[model samples]
Target: MKRKVDNSYGIIPFYIPSEKIVEKSKGCYLYDSEGKQYTDFESGVWCANLGHSNDRIVKAMEAGIRQSIHHGYKFRNHPSEFLSQELVRITGLEKGSSVFLSSGSEAVNLAISMARNITRREKILKIHNSYLSAYGYGQITPGNNHIENVHFNDMQSLDETNFGEIAALVLETGGASIDMVRFPDYAFIQELVELSVANGCLVVADEVTTGMGRMGKWFGFQYYDFLPDIVVTGKALGNGYPVSAVTVSAKISESFGKNPFRHLQSHQNDPMGGVIGLEVIRTIGDENLLNRCLDTGHYFKERLLFLNAKFKQEIREVRGRGLMIALELDNSVNGELVSDLLFERGFVIGYKANTLRFLPPLVIEITEIDKLITNIGEILELLRQ
Candidate 1:
């Protein structure tokens, strides 16, 4: 596994580029070009729920490719049709329909577009710190008149908001963007939904990172009481493959019938994307990964809590739901250094500012978690010394 060429020469550096060239990934481990094994605790950007190179998903993809890979928007594919039905059923949408796309950004933007079209309004509401998409109206930008920000758990902000011209309220329960992992207050979410609906504004759940058993459920919105008019899912939906879906409730779907909404993309509703998404859903159900995620997530959180207790001065708080856990370190501690040390010890996790994020594959075993915990404890101890 030797590097044959400089990989970063022609590529745009989106974030800080990693020096290591990963040659292979299997299950929960990655093999670098130098043949070094590193545990992938972040699930390859929080997408590989079933693990890297899952046999079932790969096989299904192969089968689908043999049938049909890409069909233009003029014609629909069988895999997309079946996937839409399954998505509707799983999301508990009443007579819902789905549209598949390549990335979370597109799905989210499309969902917002649908909301605006149905309500015939321009304004979209989003939580202050929640990250919905990479671009378009979903992405928060200064001077963006179409978007409005409401503070999470702040009743004053919600009450002050004039929902008169609002089209939809986009909600992201898993706050991976702001502070690694933060769940909103249950009461606030309930009240927010009620207010949005009462004001004729649709509710959109941005479950890009929180969907497909990431939060120990089919969707993050399930943790709350209300159902979203539109549900957007990505990340774990494709098991590392590029696929996303926007599922709309019967009401929203029916609105499109009377008031047409046209969306066209090159890879929209591709059969391969549909097959991969379907297989990911089916595999999670057949293998019972949701319950497994809950069990492993509990055990993992408990171990992290033990470390937190042991190093109370260094660790700040442990929070998150299911496998989407986060360890907030003391302000004095350098989270980037801790993450770098973990990488040196053959573990790959995510760090932003003072938070260490963990989104491991659901198939990860207890022993692997134990290894990570042991390493984390040792790292914290060393930092203290």
Candidate 2:
């Protein structure tokens, strides 16, 4: 097919050359230049928790842009102050403080830096399958020995005795977003937290993809009983406005006074981004989106269970919490093929390895959810033949 879109300048060629260019988005649907509407279940890479083009958020963003005098580097901004307080209140970290950044990568990097600084330890431990950005210690390139990777299922391998040498253990609160969304056991996570505490190691909860009511809570860490020393949040924090933050506990904040904690970026603490973030948080509350996500997630899972019962041979498993769900298919069913078929059927979902992932927007309706589930069943039936 002839294509009008240019791929020459694109850094990552994730899609084929003839891919449709999305012209606009509203709520949980995306419209291409050809005026074809696709039910966006991936939620624009899982950041649009409030859905695309939220009216209230758009208005707030416009006013913020118009009124924002400075980016708050040398001078202070009111939006930053308001956002910091909101973050503290929402996260239930009244004693903690936050630092705003531009991306999830930056937030993870800053949180790790703070952990290392406070604990004065060189070694850091993280889950093997967890995705914690690709920058600094989070980066998993070869020859990197400072960070140690431990399998979640195999906790015995993690050295829990190195109290003095280990700085922190970074964890993704819900599931790892790799080939498929693999949520670790709640009991296992709690045990790990207890182990870290016993060993005097700090805990850094990486909530990049799982925060902002994605898991039916303000932050994924809240789902667990324990509170992390450092909480890294991004993705949906500013909805589609490009903002992230690293919030530190009172103890870590106090430790900063003992030594210099240096980290800065050009877009760090920008008032415009702060305003957008605050608005996103407000919209989630005003719209009562958390309970909506919880209820919808339950309904979605039940539908998946019905599909599982009908297509037992093709489907392997269905798992995840809240709106962050996944369906694992047997080796015979190709994930990429399923994704392509869904796209052709006017639905947008994520295909990673052998799993079909769903992160539908919180504003998604029951009718749209029915459409997605019905389409999947039809596609799987056709592929079976």
Candidate 3:
């Protein structure tokens, strides 16, 4: 069989597939062209909270297609309205506003634009590793809006001087922003928020990875004590359908009316994207999967801890929130090697550098997690031997 192209991201043969092709996928499992099945843990880049080929999402999208497929940007569509309104209800931001886009990077880029545009400030602060969509959005306009990196927990670096000239601070709620080596403390995040507010700056939380119950809450910021001036939600918002959204406080949104910050593309708020995303959110609340994520997070964390305790040297630490987990290895085996071994055993996972990220579908059964633990334990033991 022929192939359309490679992923262009890597030499691991990119989207060519180790096998012929992924014939079909469902729930938490995927079948390749050879009838071989593998458990999906990556969630198609950490976005498939509702899992693969969800019927409700699929049907909702089909219904949207049955209606108007595309419409003007200014005129509101039902799906976009439903999504923005539903997100507003969920986040409870007091008339919070939403701007739609089709990707995490785009959503984040627009967010930075909004912050600079509204606050009329010229500096942006980010931690050591930032996944806040501020990346590659041009070089901060050369001191017009300079960037300072605090390296995650260097919150002690959050004094008035360092944050000076800063209009907003952007952060990712999950482990992606700072790498698996270190994550920030919630207290520090709230502190930053309070400080920024007092000093006349906005706070932006990039919840693309940690939102939608992947982290046991609608938004990871909910776990923290305070609110941000702007919040960016993507990834699971469209469940792998390339849709993203930025929600801002009612106060900041007012700036747009005076000088509209035009963002979004032709496909930004596709009817299909909105309807499917809406159904996915509804399914999450309806099934109370949020609660399941919390319970299962505890259970999964306990099991992982047992492994960490068992192999104290190789396992540096087990960290992350809810269904998003990272197994930090201090050993020389390497994360990519471990991931490859697991893939050979019919488990698909990806890693960030040496840190292995495990983001299984929210609907993943506890038994499946156990199986993963068992496989990982046996492999690590063999490697040590």
Sequence-dependent TM-score of model 3: 0.90
Model 1 weakest lDDT span, ten residues long:
1-10
lDDT of 2 by residue, 213-271 (tens): 99788888787788888888888998887899988788888888897889878888889
Error of 1 at 86 (Å): 0.4
Best of the candidates, TM-score = 1
Query: Per-model C-alpha lDDT, please?
Result: 0.90, 0.83, 0.77
What TM-score, over all chains together, does every model reach? 0.97, 0.94, 0.90
Candidate ranking (TM-score, best to worst): 1, 2, 3
User: Which residue pairs overlap in candidate 3's backbone?
Assistant: 122-145, 128-151
RMSD of each: 2.7, 2.4, 3.7
Taking the tens digit of each residue's C-alpha lDDT, what string does model 3 give over 1-385? 2345665655665345553468898888888877888898888778888888888878887788889777867677778878888887887777877877877778777887788887787667776565555455423335433676665566657763456577778766565534752456877777777777787777888788888888888888787777787878888988877888888788877878986777658877767777877898899989999999988888888899999999898888888678888888885766677887888788877665677778888989988889999999998998887
Residue 281 error, candidate 2, Å: 1.2
Candidate 2, residue 305: the lDDT equals 91
